[model samples]
Target: MYFAKRNSEEPEIVIENTVVYACESASCNGWMRKDFASENYVCPMCGSQLIEEVRELPKIQTDFNSFK
Candidate 1:
């Protein structure tokens, strides 16, 4: 007897691996990580400015049992 073929899952893609940082005006007190897909990010409180800090984050490789 013949068996049907099984499809395999696609590999995961690591898009952004850096931590984003932003700071708004002292009075505004509004800052957060901007979405990568977004065009412009502005502070909601004071509308000062939104800055992004991109840095290489460490990657850890382990066995499957690591999740346990």
Candidate 2:
């Protein structure tokens, strides 16, 4: 049996310790990146409080031009 090789290789994903806001409610799984979080640390999903946390997250490129 022979296997065919792919033409291109997948890009490597970069991960880093990123600060985020997590919901305090046990039933809610709402979270947002620190940089994108609003002044208020309120959970939009369940109206609960959000706490600061550090998580290993993949690096993302932001497009500021897209925002109005």
Best of the candidates, TM-score: 2
What RMSD does each model have against the real structure? 12.2, 4.3
Model 2 segments more than 4 A misplaced? 1-7, 64-68
lDDT of 2 by residue, 10-40 (tens): 9999999999999999999999998899999
Taking the tens digit of each residue's C-alpha lDDT, what string does model 1 give over 1-68? 99988768766755557555454566664545433324566765666676776655544345742664
The C-alpha stretches of model 1 lying farther than 4 A from their native spots are 1-18, 54-68
Clashes of each: 0, 0
How accurate locally, in lDDT, is each candidate?
A: 0.55, 0.92
| 55 Cα displacement, candidate 1 (Å) | 10
Question: What TM-score quantifies how close candidate 1 is to the native fold?
Answer: 0.34
Per-model TM against the reference: 0.34, 0.80
